[model samples]
Target chain A: MNDVRSINCTQCGAPLELHGGHRTRSLNCAYCGAVMDSHEGYKVVEQFHDTLRPHCPLHIGMQGVLKDVEFTIIGLIQYQTEEGDTWIDLQLYSPTHGYHWLSDEQGHFIFSRRVRDIPKPAHISNFKLKAPVFLGKQRFYLYEQYRAKVQYVEGELTWIAKQGNWLNITEATAPPVCLSYENSVSEEDYYKGHDAHTEKEYYYGEYFFPNDIYQRFSVEKSAQDKPEGIHMAQPYQPGLTAAMGQVGGYFFWVGLLALFVILFMNADEQPRLKYHFNQTELSTPTLIPFKVEDPQKLLEFRISVDRLTNHWVAYEMVVQKEEENVLIVEKEIEFYEGRDSDGYWSEGSREARALFKLPAAGEYSLSVLFDGGSQSTPPPLFVELYEGVVVVRYFLLLMALSLLFYMWKWFHRRSHENRRWEPVTEDEDD
Target chain B: MSTSPYPAYNCAACGGPLTLKFRYTKIITCPHCGAGLFLEDKAVKMRGLESVMADYPSLFSLYENYAYKTQKLTPIGQVRFEYAHGFWDEWWTLMSSGEACWMSVDEGDIAIEQLVTLDKMPFMPDLQVDVEIELLGESLRVTERGSAQCIALKGEIPEVIMIGDNFDYVHLSGAKGRLVTLEVQNGNLFAYEGQWIDPFEVKRL
Candidate 1:
């Protein structure tokens, strides 16, 4: 910390402590509203009476570490737009990094520093809404343009700022980072023309959360203001729900991979039993014997009939182990196709499958009996039984739930971005 | 009689004892009468009385040794220049390696630079803010262009210091904190190239 310098106001004789270094051009006396020229020896350059001191959480000489650099709050200026929207900008000075600004609009804070590099098409008049503005290699979109008048000032500033001094500000943002162009317009310039150029400055700003600001400056919770709306430069903060969604996204891919692996592993297996029968053979109950080697694995019975358009077939089967019925299954296979106004349409399938577990590894006989059909005589059908099949319906269900979870977070982030870029009207600002 | 290791001389105006700390010192102020003196062919000549600067917080003091990063520097002389807005101080420093450099202090901003020869000189009247100029094969943009008058002087300076001498200066900046300062005095041009130094990195020795 540097030593504090004090001087008596030339107008009201009130002692004012200077917190800034030699670059400070003006010091506004809080006691008498006298703007003193710091460069030319504390002379009263301008005076404004009855100017109310604006409320600010941080005071002059308050030092804090921002972005690993120690800075002291040297000055504060409050600005109000014609529509009554107000914000406060604090001038921060560091011995090494020089001067910067901390802007407080409502509860949001943005840290900005003057940049020497000029942006292409330096003036705001050449800018369009949402058009890309290039500063060096980085690109930004125009965010807002407004004219604000200085309402109050205290401590010291790099430039002389009198009350009612108007400034035209143009802001462009690329999320969490923004570029600002400020043109100071005095009353004389305004009377001359709106395009009269005065002092032009460019600043690059980064958004800071309210909590981060409070914690950085060690301000009390009571002094903190509640954030009302989304700040233009505020980056999307993924909350706990969004984190969960990201985790779900990972799981969704894992579930799909697991389903693929199961299908790949089951691809080379040969059926344990294969049976062919005609419609005449199924007129009565026919027995087909098959031996099950592994009772722990699941058994799949697949039945398919020859192509029979606009026809259907149904059958019932009983699995018996040593004359004792272990499982009874019923299935139907139907194929129907026709042309519609939109396109060719098809319904049903020619194949049906059933899954079951055998009680023991033993010889089992399947008794097949024709139940019903579209015709008096059913078509010939083929039956195949396989073991060690895996169910993929559970994996599909898991994937569906995971995708929904992730989409929830994605939509939330999208909405936040939408609100951040939403245009503000005069009524909305009020 | 003097115990100083460097060459010692008598002030031209006051006949006070003076010592040249650096090999390239061209001008110095007499301690007794504050008269600015210049050295020509082993003879000291009087220039004029230098104005004293108002006291303020500064990072460097005349004839004070300081450590900046890995290099040790001693500020032998200081020249204060008053511009339209404010004034800045340029300290002619003697480094441990026997090299002389200039440390410019404007507000809290500081830079250490040494004189460098450029292949092409920029036209003084054509220079403006945001204009790009090539210096030592590097493209630099003019960040500031202004004229300043010397307000005060102290200690030994490598360049001739005349009180109230005005010079137009242009500050050009490039990538990675590179700084190039171009000063036009009378009709001659001087250029210095260096990087901006952080004041916090300097420690008094």
Candidate 2:
């Protein structure tokens, strides 16, 4: 056997030579008739032997970063390029799905006709000039043309390119300026809205160029350093919380309004729960008929409170006089009670139908208390001792405070959950 | 005429000054030398219709606005950029994601595909793959494995290529070892790649 010479072509899979033939700067493949020329310089590829196959072969999803004249693989490729004198075609999948013909010319691998039908992350495109491009989950066309310059920093791949820029057809065209910082009248203030170094300025909400290129393009930031986007956000829409706040606030005031209305509207016949000392228990056991002169005087005894039960009711004590000490009997009195279906107050007796009789009298204290449990929880009980400029003002202030406390707790819980969830990883299928 | 980059139009076949003609292109045909001299970029431009020439395959993409519009074509070999659209949008309409895209000769047609699924691609065999990642101006051989093989590196990947999620494909090419950078802006594959791929097949490919 004449030793078959065993050399192979890296591009078209043609046989290559081992020695003298490669020295002329241009070499001809015996089989494929391809002319390989070195612009800067060239390397002679060895034969495709079993041992070499283990060292240098192309595979799928194989990612390669640009190295000095050589591509160092970072991932993998799914398909191989049709062999050219100095190029190899491949299909890549990181930024998007597409095909590329990678060529190794002199000390550089040139990529051409690489197609992608997907969005990519924020990065500079190798085929375009320096600009921030958005890569996401959308169908877009991207073109990148770059040469290989191998330099590693802390074991990281880094290469410099002369020129490259790209275009995104479907993107919103422009991004609004984000200026979350402004107005301190110093360097500290300017740094807030401006990244200083990384900050990129744009003319419209549609395009972003380099910060220095503004002389050629239209670029402006707001007078204030408030980071602004195209969409200005509004206060949170009244949701269950907001609506509740409105209702809470409305009824809170309305409830307050209703409380004042009950106190004042019934100025003539305020539901007064007076402690009538029973004549049978007193030494002066005379049955003296009692008449109320003005109902507005009743407001001085009971307090109005709001409860979840959706109605206003009053609670007070009925007492009987015994020499010097007073007896207590707690009872609830709903303002709506004792009223006919037509909502008119019902009369008690024949002689003076609207009149109520008290057997005896003594100084008494009025206390309003809430009735705990039943089909409905009792309305908040408010006991008014003195009805005047001082008492009424103090009562209203108390009600306002209680409403604010409830709202603050609700909002705090909701905001906490929004920040807790972890964002999805990059590898998972979107 | 602009000064030619080369010294003489000599036919590789016969060592003689060949007369340039557009038999179809800027090929130096030696009426005397009888040798073929193909000056790729120059010859194609001289033909004027170089703008109309279909250098690569015309792929019909139902994904973009101009899904199947026809025009000239060029081959952008391979460069990484983010496939910045969603899977469906990028693959079908060129919407959403970013991808590391490159050109591969399929039969006679050139097609663009993302690099994420390339590892399992039926067409890509189990060849040895060596990966180098450039991060923060640093070059490092991050992964070297067989097909379907993966290697974890320590540098931050501003973005990674995924099957369903969009990503970026960095285009690496430049003088010496320094690679130039460019981006795939938007819509119509051939028009986009045309910016980078040389019109002349001889010099570019």
* Candidate maximizing lDDT: 1
Candidate 2 lDDT by residue in tens digits, B29-52: 244533323455433112111111
* Docking quality (DockQ) for each candidate: 0.18, 0.02
> Per-residue lDDT for B17-133 in model 1, tens only?
986787667898887888888987679998756587788667788888999878999998988999987688899998888788999988668888999998888887787998887
lDDT of 2 by residue, A1-430 (tens): 0111234554577655322111123333333333333211323322111111111133222344321111222211111111211222222222221222332222122333312222243333243312234433322222222222111100001111111111111111211211111111122333353322321111111122222222211224321122121121111234565566555566567668767776785466533343333213222222222233433432234333343232333233333333332333344443232555777464221111011223334343332233333424444333323322123555677567546744753574345322211111111223
Task: Show model 2 residue runs off by greater than 4 Å.
Answer: A1-430, B1-205
**Per-model TM-score on C-alpha atoms:** 0.66, 0.19
User: What are the root-mean-square deviations of the candidates from the true structure over C-alphas?
Assistant: 9.5, 25.3
For candidate 2, the lDDT comes to: 0.27
Model 1 chain A poorest ten-residue lDDT run: A421-430
